[model samples]
Target: MKSIAVKNIKGRPARSVILVVISMLLTFAIFGGTMVISSLDSGLSALENRLGADIMVVPFEATTQKKFDDIVLQNAPGYFYMDNARVQQVLEREGIAQASEQFFLASASASCCSVAVQIIGYDPETDFTITPWIKKSYSDSLGELDVVVGNDLNAFVGDTISFYGVDCKVAAKLDKTGTGFDTAVFTTKDTIKRLIQSSVDLGMNIFGKVDPENTVSCIMINAAAGFTPEEVVNDINLHVKNVKAIQSKELISGVSDSLGGVSGIIRVLICAVWILGVVILLLAFTMSVNERRKEFAVLRVAGAARSRLAGIVLGEALMICIIGSILGVLLGFAVILPFNGVIEQALGLPFLLPGAGRCAGYALASLLLCTLSGTLAAAVSALRISRIDTGVILRGDN
Candidate 1:
């Protein structure tokens, strides 16, 4: 019976190809859309956990042209300076529990590659934000000239990265954080100071005679018990001079909103494709069955049962769905896995693909859905073909 179904499909190559293409499109829509949505959702969650701060404080100039937002959310390389003393001032404000200062510098080319990345200098003793991830890979104190690279960076522990002729040894590499910051290079305040001095010596004019030791780039603060991040931010903005303070959520809101929009569009496209594919497939099967009425009647006269006729119709659909599903899934994997970075850059959102188990689940789910849609679309035609007036179709009677 299956062989007969296969023979029937091979008998008409064009119609079979069209049906297979429809099934392929259906599977591709489901798998591709779900993968994108899943990656964005997971990436945002990781960024939230990695931030671990209530408020961010930076020199008011960093807010100019949305420079700071670009630096934090998109990892666009730029830097501004504020007096390091502001860290203590912010920490002393009411509703502030703890604060740590960080310094920033931009390298046009990290020694290992020509890609630009941010160099962040954090206080080793007072920091809360960068420490959690750092401890996962390294526990020893970061010596001067020792640096920790983010997971997205090409450098590994034991590799040396140079900045403006200053070489810093990579002491550790932090795990993936699923944010643009993953490309940043982290180091002690002393190490970044050295890099700053090196750039100054090379006449790079990055600092313009500003004393590097007395300046830090930004501050990350945690609000005290019973104090919200909003309260802390407001207090700092009101009390501090020449610096801007903002709640952490404000920095992430843009990403959240973008993710929501992208995910919505993907889902809509998936639904639209699924509906259209089913309609086209149903029409194709019905028209093909109609064109083969006399062929079915001849087989019935040769002792084929009605159930056997229906099975052949469904079997052809099942074969198309299985082949199409395999092809679609392979195509999805080829594009999504290799080009995830390009997708992230294009969408301007961090993207971290789901783990192995989740990917397998999605693949299996899409395959099953494609198969169900195929068989169901053919069902109506199968029923009609099985119940035909074979005597009329065969005997040449009106």
Candidate 2:
């Protein structure tokens, strides 16, 4: 029975093949876009979860010209300085398990290329968050004046960087972090202090090595196990001075939600591609069925039950769907391959490219759904063939 169906389709397969190709193309484009975006979201969510820190404490007094609350909460670019001594003070508080400090050095233009580096001044000994990633990516070589550049930093490991008139060696290149950190440069607190004291061609006074005293831009706190984040933030806000502690969940969600405009546009474009593909497929299938009315009628007259005839119609559609879907998936990946690096750099994020197993699964799922729809449509159309009077149709037709 299947052989007969195959032979029948082979008689005039152009339209059927075209419909399948169009349907597959649409499904691939829509799902592919969604998958890529979801991968990015997953990577970011993972980073946030792994950090395990309950709150971020940034200097509220750093920006005297502007509102400190607005700068920290709204993500305005500014330098806020808090006494380095507060690191121990925060840790001494009840329910605070540990605390880490970070110094943010703003971006500056260079002679060759313009780039922004978020110089994270971390205590290499105490920073558990980066130590593991750094150890896995590098050995004991990452040191002062030897920086770990983010994957998207647009510079190589051996590249020479002159910031604030202090030259540094790019010790290692990081894998794409898929966050603001990806565009950042990491170093010790003392090194960043020196860089600020020196003057660069841009005339920006970023480092201050003048005084023995120093301040940090922010403090990240890890709550003791079993302590709630809200309780932690409340406790800090009440006891801590000149700084605000924000919960991690709230901060990451705020950033992701703020990207709604960009996400919405991509979703809209995906829907449009799907709609256009379906329209093309529907037209092609309808035309194919019309041209084969005589064939369907003949089958009905030749001891083929209406249900069996319907299955054959659906089978033909399914065959085309499966083939087209496979082709479309291959084509989609081919399209994404060329721009993978640029996409990672521009977005300051890492990409989770689907492996063969994942791609195969996605292709199979897409084909199954499209085939089911095509089968149902063909089944309905085949019913019309059953209603026709075979004698009248056959006799009237040439």
Candidate 3:
């Protein structure tokens, strides 16, 4: 019976090819759409956790807003400085629990440091953010000459990274954060101070006479109990001078909005593709069944049961679905895995693909769905042909 079904499919090569293509398209839409949406959701969640701060404070310059968004949202490497006194001011605000000063230094094009890398200097003694996360891999404090490279960096532990001629050892590498931090280089405030001095000595002078001891690029703050991030941000903005405080939630909300728009478009495209696939499959199957009516009637006359006829039709559909779905899933992964970096860069957002188990689950689900759709498309014709009177069909009656 299965052999008959296979021969029937092979007999109508164009119809079989069309059905397979439709099934493949449906599977591709399901698998690819789910993968992208799932990855974006995971990446955004990781970004929120990795930030670990309620608010970020930066200098109130003309382009500060754009710069902040670039660094945080787009992961663009940048360097901006403000007086260290702003950190103290933020800490003094009501409902503020702790504030850590951070220094930013951009490597010059010809500097020994990695080109265009954002060097972030954190105060280990007062920091409540990056340190705790780093403890997941290394328990000890970061040494003056020791640095933790972001996961995206090319260097590994024990590898020395030169910053303006001062070589700093990579103490450890951070986990992937799916944010700017993943590409950033982190060290103690004291270490950055030395790097600045080295740069000046080497005549790099990227920031020209800026005193690292008195300057900081940003402040990361945590709210005390009974204080909300929004409240802390408002208080800091009101009390602090020459700086801006941004609530983490505000930035996250903006990113979420952008993601929602993109996700909506993807969902719409997936639905359209799925509907078109189903329509094409239905038309192809209908035509195929019409052409095979005489063959089905012959089988009925030969003592083949109606159920057997239906089975043959469904078997052909099942075969097409299985092969097409597997091809589509492989194609989906082939596109997603190799070009993930390019996707992330183009999207300018955090993106983390689903793990192996989740990916397998999605593939299975897609296969099942494609099979069901194919079966339904074939079942309509199967039922119609099965219910017809074999005598009338054989006698050539309309």
262-285: candidate 2 lDDT, tens digit per residue: 467668987787666666665666
Q: All candidates: CA RMSD in angstroms?
A: 2.5, 4.5, 2.3
Ranking by TM-score: 3, 1, 2
lDDT of 2: 0.64
Clashing pairs in 3: none
List the global CA lDDT of all models.
0.85, 0.64, 0.81
* Runs in model 3 lying further than 4 Å from the true structure: 10-14, 62-65, 203-206
Better of 1 and 2 by lDDT: 1
How far in Å is the alpha carbon of 254 misplaced in model 1?
A: 1.1
Off by over 4 Å in 1: 109-115, 395-398
lDDT of 3 by residue, 55-161 (tens): 88888882345677767544466677777677677677898788888777766667476555878788988988778888987788887789988888899999988
lDDT of 1 at 13: 93
